[model samples]
Each structure stands twice: as structure tokens, then as C-alpha cells.
Target chain A: MTFLRDTATIFSREFAPVWRDPLSLVFTMAQPLLFLYLFGPLLENGTDTPGPAWQWFVPGILIMMCLSGPLMAGYFLLLDLIGGSMERLLVTPVSRTALLVGRTLKEFVVLLAQAVLIIGLAVPLGLDPHVPGVLTGLTLLVVFGIGLGGLSFVLAIVSAPGGELFYGVTQVVMFPLLLLSGVLLPVENGPGWLQVAAAVNPVTYVVEAERALFAGRFLDAPVLWGAAAAVVTALLGLHLARRRMARGL
Target chain B: MIHARGLTKTYTLKKTSVDAVRGVDLDVEPGQLVAFLGPNGAGKSTCLRMLTGLLPPTSGTARVAGHDVTTEAAAVRARIGYIGQKGGAGEAFRIGDELVTQGRCYGMTRRAARSRAEELLTVVGLDGMFARKPSTLSGGQRRRLDIALGLMNRPPLLFLDEPSTGLDPASRADIWSHILRLRADHGTTLFLTTHYLEEADAMAERVVVIDQGRIIADGTARRLKADLAGDRLTVTLHDPADVPRAAEIAAGLPGAAGLASDGPRLTLRVAAADRALPEFVRALDAAGLKIDTAESSRPTLDDVFLALTGRTIQDEEA
Candidate 1:
């Protein structure tokens, strides 16, 4: 109970600043909207995957939004490290796991809002996402956001010179994961090696699940796999973040 | 409130190791204000970090406020307030909010934390500036906020790492006055690190001088000065011709050592300026040399440092 209270306090602490500066919120949402509006349309007529182009593209855009939100969490952690804010909190009696959990939950909340806005925008653009499936997909996206954000926090803590190392390494890692996951393109019709790689990518399962849910395929194998992938990613990410912080972060 | 034996910290770099603090033994009684004096890279900050449970020592052990720093770090942290070299308040929060939140971190209820924040703000003389952000506060004001944050829990012992390092003269004096008041009112034991020799000389009841990761001298400033660095008497002759003759007469007297003349003036290092000055004056008068003026000066902490280490803190800094 104390852990939850402390996490709430930290969450409020992190949220208040971003709330004060609405420009940060606008900027955070702008990039995903730009991708959805600009790059999203270019793929409209290209894919012949037996569905409306918007339905096929919306899942990728949703996952893209999820990835982008958590990817920036590393930068926030880096700022806290450089600014001595992390050290300030470390000296306090607040639970170490509470610190990371608080920030991860904040990112999760923001990512959920972004997911809602993306799906709402898609509905008007000829995308007919099933209500129950979209709800389930949004829940999975929240878990994925926490996991991804937790991983970012870990990267920030373990890496020396947290800023450049996190950015450089995450950029290298994120692009490969995104490409292999078929967020922007279908891997089914691609080369056999690409398909094999996509099969191994955890994000590929999430993207496939979202694509199935977007087409109103509820209670399917894709949903189970996507939810499972999100849960595993979340567990690993949270555990890594908490363990790193526990070891003198 | 602080007791440590052989507390050491060694940082292992890529292929080599640097011993930042080596086998330091320290003890401080309750309510005693100790000024930790050292040059840069003397491991003062590292020592403070170790004691406050902010950093673990590489070897040895310490107990701060009755909690072992290594095994009971959380207990130590709960009992002591550490104001780091850099102010601990974050950039985003207002002064009152920061203090309140810090109080909550120590398990205070929100109402209690709010009241404590108000009381501390008044204590630090920041009553009207509660709404101001930390970044908007002046350097001295920010330090006061840091102090307020540190005092949120009202710990019996407080550790301030260079509290007045970057402040102006008036601000430094202001900080010292508040520190003294904290000791008087709450009996908070203050163990502070500083670069200012005069601040330690004038303020601290006890001064611990560390050099090259070792405690070279530790005592009251007066005792350290009188024991390590004796008083001096500088006599100026009426004419440049009288300098060597005055020096010769002064050197013959007891405790008048390091006698040297520069131009029309001659200086002698002596044990006690009060006892040695009159005899030296009589000797100079007996030598038929007319004295222009004479003055005796007591040794400062710098002098003590120089005597102990063969290098002044300023020289070490350079």
C-alpha cells in the first residue's frame, strides 16, 4: 500500500511538469499524428492484403505510436540523471521500484491517450475497428508501453553518459525491431529470411495481433500471442528496471 | 552522531584504481558543529557521501546516527539529512511544493508536510517566496531551500556538502548564521565541508583538515594554529641599514626563529607574539637600532595547513 502511494506521488511529480507545459504534450502527440496523416496515406493503395488500406495500416500506426512514446522515456530518464533529480529521490525513503513504476505508469497513461486519439482519428478515415477488439488492443498497447518505457529507464540507468549512449543504441535497436515487426510493411509477401526474422521479433506478434483485432477478429490466436508478447515484455522490462535501480542507481 | 573507522573508497577505472579516501577514522559528538576542511580532490565529498549512505565505501565500516552505512543504509538515510554540493531541489517544483514532497518522502502525512514546509520556509527566511520555482531563486535562496528540504524530517544530524561555496560574502555569512541558529534551536549536529578557511576558523567549534585522502590535523582552530603554526612578530627598522642589525639581535632571543629582513623591515617567527615581542623590542633598543613600527599577528588556519602539509590550500588548488 505504501509502495502504491509512493508510486502515485512520483507519478504526480512527473506529470505536473508536463502538464504545466502543454507544448510538450502537443509535441509528443504531433509526431505520431504526422506519421498517421502523412506516411500512413502513402501505404493506402500499395498493400493488396485483402482488406481496406486504413484497417491494415492503423495497427502499424498504433504500434508505432506505442514505440515512439516509450522511446522518448529514455530521454526523460537521462534528463533526471543529469539534473540530479534521480539522486535527490534516491536519497529519500521512496521505494526504488516505485520510482521506475511511477514513471512507467505515467508513460503508459500518456501512450493510452495517444492510442485513443489515433484510433478516433482512424475511425473517421474509413477504418472500421471493432469496439471490443480495439479495447483489447488498447489494453495490450498500455502494457507494451510500460514494458518499453521500463526498458528505456533501464537503458538510461546502466549506460554511462546516459544521453548519447541511450539515444544511439536505442535508435539502432528500435529501427531493426520496427522493420522486422512489419509495422510499416507486411512481411508475409517479403523474402523468406525477412519472414523468419519477423517470426522471431516479439513486436511482430503484437503488430499481427493488432492487425487481426483491427479487422474485428476477436478471441483469436493473434490476440493471445500479442497479449502474451506484451505481458512478457512488460515483466522483463519492469524487472530489469527495478533490478538496475535496486543496485545503486 | 558520526563514527567511522578505516572508512575507505576506491574507484576502479578501466585498468587502474584511484583511492579517493583511504582508511579515514572520524568521530563527532552530538550537537557539535564540525567544519571539514580540504583542498579539491581531497576526498571530503566522498567521505560525506559514504557517511550519509549516498555511496558505499569500498572497504571498512561506518555507523551514522546508530545505523551501519552498508547494511542499514535505508535506516541511515531515514535519520540524516544530506544537502549535497549541488542543491537537491528539482527544477520544476515551487519551493513549498518541493519541501512538502520531500517531507512526504520521509513518511510525513500531506497535512503535516505542508505545515512543516511552512515552518521551515519561515526558519530559512523564505516565507514570501513559496510560490517561486527553484530555478528562479537566487543561489543563496536556492541553498536555503535545499536546507529547508534537508530539515524536512528534522534529523538530529545534518550533513551539508560545501553549503556556501558559490555564494557571495554576505550570503556566506547569512548561511553561517542560519547554521548556527539551527544548532542552537534544534541542536542539529552539523558536519559541513568547506573551502573557506576563515569560515571554518571563525565558525566551527572543531575543524578537521584532510589532505591527500588523510586526516592530517583535527582540533579546534585555535589549538591547531597555536600548536602547529606559532605567532609571528614583524618589525620595521627606521632605516634600511638597521635591518640586518635588528635581525641579528632578534635571532639571539629565545623562540624568535625564521628571522629574515626584507629591505627596511625584518620579520621573525616566534612561539608566542605576546611574550616574545617585548624582549625582542628591548634587544633591538639595546642594539642601538631605532624601530619605526612593530606588529604581531596570530596564525590562521592556512598557516596551520601549511605547517602540517608543507603546502597551503591555495597552493594545492593551483
Candidate 2:
């Protein structure tokens, strides 16, 4: 009960300010738009047939949106820690489990919101985001974002940088995940070793399964791997982040 | 309440191992406010961290509010409020919601958490800053808010680490006032560590002075000062050359720890001036060295600490 309470409190308190800041709000909306415009038609128009290309690009964009939400949340974790804010929080009756769960869930909630906004916008761009199926797929994406964000928080916590180095780490975590997710191009077309690398990339399943959902195409292979990826990543992030926070290092 | 026996911690840094808190034993009732005073690197912070269960001791056991901090840290945390040396609010959230989140984290319902936050903000003198962001607060204000957050659960014990480090004089007084009143209002035990000698002397009922990972002295400020050192006497002679004669004269007095020439003045440590001053002055007149002026004052905690440890409290930090 205390865990849920703490987590929810952290979620609401943390997400509220980001929601209010106009600049952050504009950037959040603009991020996916920039990605869609920059990566979308460039890859699609470059291809012989742009129709299927847009279809593929839509899922990729949505996953990227989901991925960015959690990755950015790590920045907050790092700020709290280095500023001595997180240390102050520990002085209270708050359980470390609650602190970890609350902070991680807050990031997940934002990523979920971003996923919804992007997935909703994807429909008119020559792509079919089957509402219910895409919602479920993005829900999985939100879960994935939570896990990734948790990992990000732990990284931010562990890195514990002072100033400009913080934003540097944020971009480092974010850009790599976006590139590796195979959001814009087919995984097989990349380098052979990169193809082998993509097999184990949970983010690969995220884009493929989400793209399949957005295109309204039911694949022969089930999306169990993507769902598992979402759960495993989220839990792993939660477990490790919780342990780290508890140690109060 | 807290009871600790043989509480010890050793931190092995990259190359060297530091025994932060070698061995300590202490007892506190449910509502006592005991101040721990030490200079920089004196291990006061390390001991508080271990006592609060933030850091595990390398050896020994501690019970906070009757719960073992090692085996039942969850319960120990649940029962105490901790305000660390650094204010720990992250960049996200309004001050109000941060307090609410803290309340909820300790098991308050949403409505209860909100109400409790409102009450605590007022108590901590942050009533008007509810909607304001934490990033907007000044250092002292942020610390007060941090205190409010620590009190969210109304824990039985509160561990405050350097609560007055960077505050202005007025702000420090304001905080000390609140700390003194907390026990009366909430019956909360406060274990505070501070580098300010005056803060510990003026506020705490009992003081513990630690130096280099060991307990150098522990007692009420009065006893520590009175038992360890005598009152200091500063005397000025009419002529500078008369200092040596005055020193030789004062040395014969009962309980007088020989006089020393301090620049143009002579100073001595006397166990009891009331009993020895007259005889010492008679001897001084016999030596034909006139005592121009003399003054005696009780020793302070700083003197006691310096006397016992062979070094002043702020000396290490400097």
C-alpha cells in the first residue's frame, strides 16, 4: 500500500511540472514531428514505393517517441541526485522501494502519454494505426519506456555528473536507442553484424510489432517477444534501480 | 528511542581505509534531542548515516526506536524522519506535490497526504510557497522545506545532519527554536550533528564530541567544560617587564597552572579564583609587580573540546 502510494505521489508530482512548462510541452510535441519529417519522407520518398514506407515509418516514429520519454526522465533522476535533493528524500520515512518505483512509474506515465499523442497523429499520414491494436502496442511501448527510463535513472544516478556532462549522458542514452530500434529501415538491410545485433535488441521487436500493429497487419509470428521485452526491461530496470537507490550511494 | 552498542564503520576508499566511526555506544529516550558536535572529517556525519540506516556499519548493532537498524531498516526508516546535510528535492514538481508524494510514500492516502502536506508546510514556515517550485527556494528555505518533507509521516525520531550549516544568523536561530520546540509539540527524538559549537552548546541538552572516529568527550555542555578545564584568567601588569615576575608570583597560588607571558599581558588557568586570587595578589605585591587589571571567565565548550582533544574543533577544517 505504501509502495503504491509513494509511486503514485512521485508520478503525479514529477509529471505535473513537465506538463506545465510551455517550452517542455512544445518540445515534447515537436520532437516526434521533427523525427517524422526528417526521417519519415527521407526514407520513404527515397524508396521506390512510398506507401509501404510511410506505413513502416509511422511505427518507427511512435516507438522513438515512447523511447525518448523515458530516456529524458533519467535527466530528472540525475538532477535530483547531484543536487542533494534525492539524498534529502531519503531522510524521510519514504522507503527506497517506493522512491524507485515512484520515480520510474512517473517516467513511464509520461512515455505512455507521448506514445498516445504520436500514435494518434500517425493515422492521417498515409498509415493505418488500427486504434485498439495500436493502443495495446503503444501500451507495451510505454511499458518499454518505463523500463528504459528506469535504466536511464539508474545510469543518471550512477554517473552522478555535475553540469554539462548530464545532458551529454542524456543524449548518449537516447540517440543510440533510436538508431538501434530499426524504426526507419528494415533491419536486414543494415550491416550483417548489425543484423545479428538487431536479433537480440528488444527495441527491434518494439518497432516491428508496433509497425505491424499500426499497419493493421497481423503477422504469422506472435508479438510475445515484444510484450516480454517490455515486461523484462521494465522489471529489470525497476529491480536494478530499486537496489541502487536502496544502497543510497 | 535508540540504543547502540559498539557501533562501528570502516569505509575502504580507493586506496586507504578510514575508520569513520570506530566504536560508539549511546542511548536516547523517545523524545530527547541529543546534539553530536565534531569538526570536519570527525565522523559525525558517518555515524548519523549509520544510525539512520543509510549506511551499514562495518560492525556493531544499533536499535532505533526499538527496531534494529540492520535487520529491520524498513521499520527503522518508517519510524524516523531524516533531514540530510544536503536538501534532496529533484528538479521535478511543485513544493506542494513533493510534500504530498512524501506523505504518500509513507502510507498516507491521497487526501490525507495533501492535508498533511498543507499542515506541515505551515509548520515549517512555507505556507505561501505551496504552489511555488522547489528550485525557486533559497538555501535556508529549501532546508526548511526538506524538514517539512521529513516530518510527513510524523515519525517518532528525526535525524538532522548539519541543520544549520549555511543558514544566516537569524535563520539559524529560527531553526534552533523549532528544533527545541519539536519535542514538546510532537514528542520526537532529534539526533542532530553540527559543526557549530554555539549551536550545540545553546540547544542540545547533552552534547557528544567526536574526533577522528572516537568519542573525545560526552556530557552536558556545562559539565564537559567545568570538569575538564578550569576558568581562564587574563591579567595585565603595569610594566611589560613585570610579566615574568607576575608569572612567578601566580605559580605559587593553589591550583594555578603557571602563568605565561602573552604579548604584553600575562594569562593563567586557575582551578578556583575565588579561593586563590587573594593569596596570589598578596604574593604579587611582595614581588613588587602591580596587577594593572585582571578578569576571569568560565570556560566554554570550545575550550573543553580543545582541552580534551588537544586541538580546537574548527582547526581540522581549517
For all candidates, state DockQ relative to the true structure.
0.52, 0.59
Name the best candidate (by TM-score).
1
lDDT of 1 at A78: 79
DockQ score of candidate 1? 0.52
> lDDT values of the candidates?
0.85, 0.77
Query: In terms of DockQ, which candidate is strongest?
Result: 2
All models, RMSD in angstroms: 3.0, 3.3
Q: Clashes in each model (backbone N, CA, C under 3 Å)? A: 0, 5
Assess every candidate by TM-score. Answer: 0.90, 0.88
Instruction: Report how far residue B180 has shifted in candidate 2, in Å.
Output: 2.3
The window of 10 residues in a row where model 2 chain A has the poorest summed lDDT is A42-51
Question: On residues B1-318, what C-alpha lDDT tens digit does candidate 2 reach at each position?
Answer: 989899998887888988889889888877777899888888889888888887888899999988999898878878888888777565567888778777766767879989998998899888888888877998778888878877888888898999989999988888877777788887888999988888788888889888888887888887787678777677788888877778877787667774678766887878876666676767778878877877777787788887888888767888
TM-score of 1: 0.90
